[model samples]
Target: MNKYNDYAKKMNCLYAELPEYLTWHKDSKEWEPRKKQEVIGRIFNCHPSDGEKFYLKLLLMHIRKPTSFKDLRTIKGKYFDTFREAAQYLGLMETDSTAEMCIEEAATYLMPAALRQLFATILVYCSPKNPKQLWLKFENFLSQDFEHKKTLNQYAIKHKVLDIIAYHLDSMGKKLQDFFFVDDDIVTRTHDNLFKEIQTERDIIIPTEDLLAIKQLNEEQKVAYDQILHHVNNNIPNAFFIDGPGGTGKTFLYRALLATIYSAGHIALATATSGVAASLLPGGRTSHSRFKIPIGENNSKPCSISKQSALAQLIKSTKLIIWDEATMAKRDIIEKFDEMLRDIMSSNIIFGGKIIVFGGDFRQTLHVILKGTKDDIIDSSIVMSPLWQHLHKLKLKQNMRASLDPHFSSYLLKIGDGIEYTNDKDEIQIPPQANVPFIDDNTTLNTLIDMVFPNINDENLDFSLFVNRAILTTRNDFVHEINDVLINRFPGEETTYFSCDENTYTCTIPDQEELFHSLTPQGLPPHKLTLKLNAPIILLRNINPNEGLCNGTRLLCKGFTPNIIYAEISVGVHAKKTVFTPRITLEAPHDNFSSIPFKRKQFPIRLCYAMTINKAQDQTLDFLGVYLKKLVFSHGQLYVALSRARSIEQLKVLIRPSTPLIQSTDYTKNVVYQEILKATDTH
Candidate 1:
């Protein structure tokens, strides 16, 4: 009888029919069971050797050394395909790389060396001549060591080989999960040998039963998920631009594909543009980390990993890769990442030349460096790159945002033109009594506290009450002048501010060191502070900066209260030298503005909802206040503001008879009208 069979049978009898298997053997160290011996005898009769010769043959089969990437790939193939044909071919092939890979793969899958040694020592006691006698010796050894906790009982036959392994070794640990083959504890050669023992080509052999048991999804998600799954299974290598409007179930599809590949015994990797987004998914890391992609490395330099490195191993073992917020990836970033993978894998490829998926909306661009269009992928570093292609694309059109401002919110994107507001949809509760009194001139505007906050208990109003004035003016002022007003309003309150422009604003603070210390441990920068401000003022910086900041010698600002105080004046420079200058230039186009308050400071300007045409673009407001003079509104300017509102009631065109709302000889005007017509048709 083979040693493993004897062991397996003895364990089976112990668990199922111990009493029936009991027997007395005086010469033995402990008592034995007759049934246990009989089962061991049956196992011997069923098969011959202890599988030692097969294992040894498998170990000695390969000859090639594994250092190059090609060698690693070859070994990876044989490691995964454990069957007669594959094993025989690998055994006959004399490749050092193949042998090394086999050793590595086996070690990864099998138990540690310490446990193997204990199993081998116990094997010495088992003999075919006195099966019952041997059984007695084993039982006694186990009983005596029960106090020492060195004995084990569990055993199972592996499905592919039907070969026995110590499934439950008491000496190894209470559970398999508790054991790990970490780097420090390993003896390099012994580790290599142990790996060789377990090395065999073993493809994933999922039974029909397990697959049948998986939970499924609703019809729509199922179809979409299946399409992606099929593409992955085929290993279709290409960029996939999946555009779904915000709140569509696009993320759900990504999760489904990941789960499938994982269930099939393959690893999956996930990444995204932001750490916050990465945190939302299981096993997600930043794309920069995954690709070893350095920030601002926009050119030919590429990151590469050795074929035998742990990172490369992890990637090779993974079957699927998912990238979210893909729209933020610039052309250069994607190309550099692809270049690195190709070098590591030794193949010109797309999707790292494996199963890869991407999810994002192109309209939300965050990549500032890449200039190439979506279709162009040129690799100057390589004579040839993978042919430009896309694998599969899915578009999601559903809108899921704050429901209270559905129509208004929807119009912010061109796609939202079709959205209709429904009472049944989600709603944002704005208290009906929250509306506040309005004013025109500086004094009345200064009394505009209720607009920011409705009641005494409303904390939003506290800032307005604490500040000195809310001056209303149509003339643009230089930033320094604005800072002056802010410093005058709040003499000593510390403040926070930022700009969402291409280049972030920098400020030099007098208390830079103190501010740095105060913000540390919280990870905020020294000059950046946090403050709360009213929505309109916030919107001015965030959305309507194109309207204009006051013209003057622009200088850094600080020390503010109620979130709008500006301080720290510097000699504003023009052409890098001329400073403290007052000359202003309106070089850029301006957003429509409400007319200067008529009748001086007599009454609050009538419901001014002024916005720049750029900020106004794609917006459909409940009401719009467009102020115009003699120059005709460009087709570009007119359409940008008009589209913001859903209908005419939402639009209030405040134009004089001579304002020239329409004019001839403007080709761009025709184009704007056609686009509006198209938008209307879609709805």
Candidate 2:
């Protein structure tokens, strides 16, 4: 028992320092720590001793370095046995490891140092002798952490740590419930509440006074709406794709269908590829959140959703599934959902024979695979999915946003369809009316800002108006600059919130300021975040779906606490509702940092005067200012930026003079694969 305890402590110490050493960059031309390795070594008291060396060798064996586990056992059978024995003794591995145990072990080995430490601490406290006392002590340890306090709080509230510990305990033939008096029904209740909100029967009957205000669908929308409604009303199992560019009343049709279904007391599950789009629906959520889609891709695996789960039951009972912005998802994601549905319902029919309606404009963004070629991207799109053959096509051509200016709408459609005339270099000129001329005067930026943000000086200005107007940029640096300028212009006392930076596993990494500087990526709030009263900010994460605080929800800074931000929802159904947002630990993806893992503990709010075009995909702005300091590099970016404004009059484009000139018109590039569209067309 003493030997096992010593082994556990050694294993814990190794994992607590491994993240600082694991990542190797070939470009650096040497093995370099993500942070200062010496600092980690000193802090963790990790030295080049026998135990540390053994731990390193074991990690290499776990990652199957340079060979498969089977091959490694054959090549170094004796070493493999030693590593296996140590792991089993430390309760990190089982003698007869199941598939689930193997997966859990792999995830454990890959976890960041902070999480490893937390897991190790939990394991150390879990005891069969004084089960209840040990459980209480464990809870207290998590709530009042030595380090990584915010991260601990987040995982505790979400029960992520508890779930992991429970899985481990089960592997040892010990039940966590027997030890702790925790409500085992908490997870089930949370899922139930989520589904209840989604299926809530609203007052679908439109008020007689507001009858005239609810505009009737045009001929284009009527055709699609009627077809979809027909399939739903008759209980027919059908798949349909409603294809349209932005502002063609896609949302209007969605709401109408939802209303119709709810009025008839049927369940309609509405989801979107993004939180911003989802928040527009009555009880919308991101597809991943609703469906339990795995973050990392594995073509062979289905979604983590199980047949006996409440979500699966909800899916089975759902009458209609409406997926908005469907084109943004990978072909594999859709196929996986189809596969899971078939398995759950024990039927080979598509999506368990349910009526599934997918809506998106192929002219906009498709699945964005990092470092993938155009061919790779096109292949990953829904148009290339096998399920496309089963889907009936419904088209919407009317431009609701550009109804007053038909010419502008036509130009936008041309840009999206890649039919607009381009020069030999493939650059199309922008029309003068659509372009905001680059002035030599220094006041040009201020003039553009004033145009977009009218009544900025008014103390009693409607906050909603400001929230609806935003400056869209092509880069994060420009966003930071514009936000800084805008906040300085605002008439209020500025408050700076400094993040609690620490390497929870070791004390060394936080001491290296240069390391923190190098690892901090865009889309994440900085260590030092400054805000002013009435400052417009956007939520960086989906904190609470029920309260309308979701990713991309805009808010005005009303007040602040040491660890919480008091803000009023600026957009969505929860608009004007005040909410408190707490600081949380956000980790950068392994791919984001050359495969190095790190977490940033900060407030999940960023200034919203300007945001990247990629971040503005599902947002609809009343007035949009596009600052083209750099040309859009990705597909659908130009289209997304231009289509955000409700009307041409509400849009303004500022192009840097350094950009290549093309006649008197403004030139933008559009990418379209006609072959994919043809493949999706039944005709």
Candidate 3:
């Protein structure tokens, strides 16, 4: 116990298992190969967005002291013309075996059902080279539990496991007949083309505290809960909006309602505008995923739901529909949802005569309008809809945090309502106590990082510190810089992984590889990713919404198994839940960076020591460092940034260095569209 209690991983007399990545190096006395200097591994980005330069950058990052381009592409005696050719010859381009590695790593932590679902997702989205081989390799782990049920009949168990996999594949719009490993019965079953509804039944995994808290809902929550339940119990069609600010217990009320309704055996369809919020609810899902809302800028299309589809059946059976963060959605999207529901349910009444509950803080950022004016943005909000007038508006003014931090709560309200005193530039002064002592811009960033994560290397530091504290800025580039500074300071050896990119479209002439690597598409991971153990990272894409892995979701890295990175969900109800992430293919936005489309295959995660201000919504933190190096550029950005912390003590602001000409470091611009607040006012 004494020998194993300290840093010693292996007991002197006992045989303890270690991961394959770790091994005893006789020369280096460390679990991992020793580095010349213990510095964070750096990534190499090409000077220009060119294909050859990008490949050269990859080689430069891995190999030290490359004299020139020719040196990087030259092996022992073979001089390769293409950098990618040299990389492949060096055994860096191929990761065909990652499929098996992903399953093996996930098998150690994920539940059998979750692991199977992950495998299915990998097969569907990841495009592993050999899907059948992955199944064969992890067949025992995938159906480990069910295998015991029919141990005497191994063939039948394998068939049953394949059937379950077939069901999962079916839900994702794929068929089992394509996989040659399936049994004849499974192949015959694919003719039905069954549209299986994901999460057919609510699992009722609500927290005990939330369940018990139902009896303790403040008067505001009780009123909203009872009014909605009245219509649900009577099967009466009604539209209602639950308007509340950040800590007003909107999620608390939703969970309570879901538990009560699910317990009564009625289907309550729970969804949210964002995946993070949706994952907090029992059986919650993104409205876009659940309703199949098309993503585009042109004339919106109705959700792709046929009347006879399983999704239509789910809509028909649904007794109540709860949509969280509804205000973040555009009015057109919501109207489209209502129209889809009406047609599917065969009713003209609002939402196809189903009970609909909408909840969000209108004070938070509205639906983003790309290159839009203030009027354009406000008009896009749900409040601007004519249907908004008909729905009964319910209010919840009792902010749960107000009881604990009165001043901060009131400050948030003042900022949210645009009542704070403004200067000539229409900016509000940040509280002095909340400001990080500023020196220079660079010094401020370092101080901001230190302030947010004090004593980060301490062994006794609370794990929640990583979850609760973050440096938030308005822009992604600023986020990248802050995260880079923090990850390097974090105590652990780092590993760097490079992406395998390909042109998005088939070109007659040729595709530029350099351009593909250079395009840092919004919401996609870069060509080079550097990660360290226990470092926090944010998911840039939604893997499985039900599992709480979604775009803007935060996780702490637990293992880095080459292809699969093991991480635990760090926020929301799914906090502490273990999940495995794989390098999924991500495509550039249509006409975003360039007309020539390209795809980047890499792990869908970025260091989250700092994240953009928009992603900071719905998160309550004990410590928050606001990097105003880039002042927030959107409505409600300033308010949302300041309001994340519970109190002024936990809040710190690091403004971009004050210019000698105009000393406005104490004040920063706050963009709040107060007109939107009128529609969301107390009913």
TM-scores, all candidates, are 0.35, 0.70, 0.84
Candidate 3 per-residue lDDT, tens place, 293-385, comes to 877654377788899887788788888899999989999999999899989988889888988999988888878766789999988889888
In the order shown, the candidates' Cα RMSDs to the true structure are 33.8, 15.2, 9.7
After TM-score superposition, the amount by which residue 193's alpha carbon in candidate 3 deviates from its true location, in angstroms, is 12
The residue ranges of model 3 lying beyond 4 angstroms of the native Cα positions read 1-58, 66-101, 104-114, 148-152, 163-184, 187-199, 297-299, 459-464, 505-511, 592-596, 681-683
- Tell me the deviation in Å of residue 374 in model 1: 15
> Which scores greater on TM-score, model 2 or model 3?
3
Best by lDDT: 3
> Can you write out model 1's per-residue Cα lDDT over 1-683, one digit (the tens) per residue?
11224433544432123334554467885445465445422111111132433322332222222333233234334442232233333332122232222222323323233223222222321112332343333332322323244343332111110111122221111212222321222323223332221121012233333244234444545566666677667765555545654444555556566556656666677666544344334445557655566654333556644566555666666667788876555555666766667766778666457666677643332343234432231221111223223445556665433344465345434422322222232211111222112222243222332232224234434433322112121112211123233333432333333211111114432212112222211111112223222212211110001111111112233222221122222211111111111101111111122111111100000111222333233223433433322222222343344334444334433222232352221111101223322321232
Candidate 1 regions with alpha-carbon error over 4 angstroms: 1-221, 233-239, 262-265, 297-300, 369-388, 400-410, 415-524, 528-683
CA lDDT of every candidate = 0.34, 0.65, 0.77
Better of 2 and 3 by lDDT: 3
For 121-187, candidate 2 gives per-residue lDDT tens digits of 2333222234344444444343333235464555345465455454334322234465544666853
By TM-score rank, best first, the candidates go 3, 2, 1
| Residue 514 displacement in candidate 1 (angstroms) | 12
